[model samples]
Target: MSLDAPYIARAAKPGQFVQIRCNDSFEPLLRRPFSIHRVKGEGSRVKDIEILYEVVGKGTEILAGKKEGDFIDVLGPLGNGFILPRTTNHERRTTNSEPRAIIIAGGIGAAPLVYLAEELTKKKIKTIILIGAKTKNLILCEKDFKKATPEVYISTDDGTYGSQGFVSKLFHKILKTTESKFETIVYVCGPHGMLKCIVDICQERKFECHASLEEKMACGIGVCLGCAVKTKSGIKLACKDGPVFNASELIW
Candidate 1:
């Protein structure tokens, strides 16, 4: 998933994504969108970019077969990224005033949060990643998350992982019972059902939350309107206006 795309790496931001075509063939004409998994560099120079993916169908199966040194087609650093917290002028030397950002992901949806957490941690913002799956083997990105923050929590619907229920439940517990000196801000990305549940919980508690959405995107750019998602404001293109949006903006 790593590519030597310095241009993209330098411009890449947390929650920003790339669209990649599997091959030169016209069979699968459209490019697939993937979150920027990680970025590597120093100062303003970037060396590489990576993406996390799962093979769910034919297109992904083709993507999985890519070999090393293979020439791939990609379009990237697209869409708006997460808005990171900033330190106050008087306390600029200290990053303690930043909110404790909670990142929630389900199944393969964990793809985007890695870079998000990386960006947040770089700003000295406290982050806790909550990952959920149907089973232990289904859980993704725990080790990677650990590399970004030690506060990674997990759960599985079948009780085969760290917790024995939905990750949303665990988040509710943390929001209600856990004691933290900093404020809380929740970020989520997952299936519709899962998002509905989490948003419901956030609404009930009046917690601030943001969500990243995935939809069928034929054109990575704004044209075609293939991936329009209904939001509270109106119809917005997931590939253009978002992929990331406030929880209040989402209708569901």
Candidate 2:
């Protein structure tokens, strides 16, 4: 869903999200949180912000029915965003010392990372993306990610397309086989099980990992504490503190 919100588009960063109200009525009561997929326009004149969502239930079903010109109640650019890699002096002059970054997306979680991949590519960082879904039809944003980097690997649980297995396993294989000596960072968004698996691998391999978590929220702000997550530093609100957190800070 593309929204004509220039203010949000200008301020939005990769890994931040928005909460949208499906209807004006109290049927759903709370809003639904969706990752800011991509921002449209260039320079300081952004025109619109886009969000990707699936019609899982009533709220999204109603959201799917919205017309293009329809006004939507959106509360946005929420939570902390991913920390992008800074361009080093050496990287500007040569490709030998360039940093490498990897993105792992599971199912609909592929939405937010497209923006991150684009930003990394613009900085000339070697960016790779691993996308996983249950089947080929469920895979999201393959074409969009390929625009940023050519190293897009895909896997499905049922072996319908690409590799036949979990994406986390594919990541492990890449980490093991790759000969690049530059620093590497991994960013991931996916099912809880997949996140945990990737985090474990990162921990064992000593690679820095960042994860975008998906959680239910009653309030998009810090109040209510409905979407609290346990981290190394105690409880943190997913809506306010983060939807993106360092893998080391997370408990599970």
Best by lDDT: 2
| C-alpha lDDT values of all predictions | 0.84, 0.90
lDDT digits (tens) for residues 1-252 of candidate 2: 889999889999999999998999998989999989999999888879998988999899999999979999999889998987657755343445556798999999898999899888888889989999999999999999999999999999999999999998788788778876766789999999999999899888777799999999988898989999999999999998899999999987
- The root-mean-square deviation over C-alpha atoms between each candidate and the true structure, in angstroms, is 2.7, 2.4
* Minimal lDDT window, size 10, model 2: 89-98
lDDT of 2 at 74: 92
Q: Tell me each candidate's TM-score.
A: 0.93, 0.95
User: Lowest-lDDT window of 10 residues in candidate 1?
Assistant: 85-94
After superposing candidate 2, which stretches have Cα over 4 Å from the reference? 89-97
- Clash number for each model: 0, 0
The parts of candidate 1 lying over 4 Å away from their true place are: 89-98
At residue 91, candidate 1 shows an lDDT of 46
